[model samples]
Target: MTDKAKQYLELFLVFFKLGAFTFGGGYAMIPLIRNEVVSKRNWVEDEEFMEMLALAQSAPGPISLNTALFIGNKRMGFKGGLVSGIALIIPSFVIILIIAMFLVKFKENAVVERVFKGIRPAVVALIAAPLYMLGKSANVNKKNIWIPIVVVALVAFLSVSPIYIIIGSIVLGLLHFLYIKKIHKR
Candidate 1:
């Protein structure tokens, strides 16, 4: 195979490993992805990784797939994107397929129900871990810290829809942007 082909294959294999091992979706996969791609392979720098992450979040499709595509493209161009995207998703596809088949056959079993019940709390904890990590990484300033506090308070006390929180964040972001622009113009 050509050098580019080999590179693409490597991308596929690396991402296949990441996808197979990571649980609890994209955010959970991030630190692992950073370790592998940035720390181990030296494929991208930390700042670049963060930028790709931001782009991945803003793009269409799953965050993992978007991340894989961006990194792969950076490494080996279009073919790398194809290989990495497929690799990132394939594990979940196969695993879910197998689980679906098994669930269809044995969902009513007491042992399976018990196992699922045990897994549920662990899954929630896994999801929360990434949120905690992101909060630390974001380094919220005094001005922005209240955004999360108000959102949490509203969600906890008032039971507001999450969409309101999202909209509020957007509004706050816009106001911050305008303020910064005004300050720069002065």
Candidate 2:
């Protein structure tokens, strides 16, 4: 295979594994994805991953799939995106199909329930791992710590829509930029 073809294959395999093995959806996969894409593949640096992750989180879709598209596009353009997306979906699609077929049989199985119960704590850890890592990566300091805490409270306690949160953040960011520019010009 040509270098480009090899790269595409690698993208397919990597994303396929991520999709297949990751149990708690995209957020839970962040740590593993970071390790593979940043630490192992050297495809992007930590800062770039944080940026892509921000963009991915903002967009509608699984963060993992969106991230895969970004990495694949960075490496090989449109074809890369297509390859990565399809590869990522295949395992999920197949697994879902198999589950749907067998779900009735396993619906009340004690062993299956116990297995899922056992995985819950691990999944929570997986989801929480990225929060600490991303917070450090994003340079979240004591000064800004209240921002995330407030957002979480709004979402969790007030039941505010995330769409509004996104819009509000955009406005705040623009205002901050303008303030910085004004200060710079003075």
Candidate 3:
């Protein structure tokens, strides 16, 4: 096969494997994404991967799928994005389709219910692991650490909508940029 075709197939297979095996959800997939894209394939630098993770989280849709699209588009443009995204979702789609067909009948099974119960804490840890790594990469030092703490508090305790937090962060970043620009002009 041609080089381009090889690249597309690589993308598809990589994401297919991730989607097929990962248990929890999008957030839980972050570490696997980092392993594949940043370490294994060398598609993006560590900082770029972290930035993509942030963008994927802030934007609508699943983080895993968004990361796939962003990385694919960055590497090979629109076709790459489409292929990567479709491949990433295909396994999950198939699995869910099968599950949906039989889920109702198994919903009352004690073993199945217990399995889900055990998965919950594991999923939480999987999600939190990436958050900690991303936070450190984003420079969450003591000086600015309060920002994330406050946001988490708001969402967890106060039940604030994440939309407001995202918007507020954007506004804050823009204002900071302007402030620095004004200071430089003085």
Candidate 4:
């Protein structure tokens, strides 16, 4: 096979393995993705990976697929993005399809319900683990630490919609940008 073909296949296989083995969902897959893309393949530097992760989280859709698309595009352009996304989704699609086929029948089963209930807390922990890592990488120090804390409190306690938070963050970023530009002029 040609080098380009090999690269595509490698991308497919790596994401495929991640899709197949990972549990709990997109957030849970972050570390595994870091392991493969940052450590194993050396496709992106740690800083770049963190940036991609942030972008992926902010984008609309699954974080895992978004991360794959961003990294793939960065590495090999549009086709790479498409291939990585499809590969990452294929395994989950198949698994969900199979589950859907049986889920209706087993919906009322006590044992199945218990199994799902048990999985919920672990999924929460999986999601939290990535959040903690991302927060650290984001330089959430004493000066800016309260930003996330406030966001989390609003979402968790006050039941604020995340869309507002995203918009507020965007506005804050713009203000910061303008402030920096003004400083440079002065």
TM-score of each: 0.71, 0.65, 0.67, 0.68
Q: Candidate 3 — worst ten consecutive residues by lDDT sum?
A: 126-135
Which segments of candidate 2 are over 4 A away from where they belong?
1-18, 21-63, 74-76, 115-122
Per-model RMSD to reference: 3.6, 4.5, 4.2, 4.0
lDDT of each residue in 68-136, candidate 3, tens digit only: 899889888999999889988999899889999999889789999999899989988876778778888
- Model 3 off-target regions past 4 Å? 1-14, 21-63, 70-77, 129-131
- Flag clash pairs in model 4: none
How far residue 155's Cα lies from its native spot in candidate 4, in Å, is 3.1
Clashes of each: 0, 0, 0, 0
The candidate scoring highest on TM-score is 1
Q: Would you give me the overall lDDT of model 2?
A: 0.90
Residue 30 local lDDT, model 4: 96
TM-score attained by model 1: 0.71
Q: What is the lDDT of candidate 3?
A: 0.89
Off by over 4 Å in 1: 38-40, 45-63, 126-133, 141-145, 152-164, 183-186
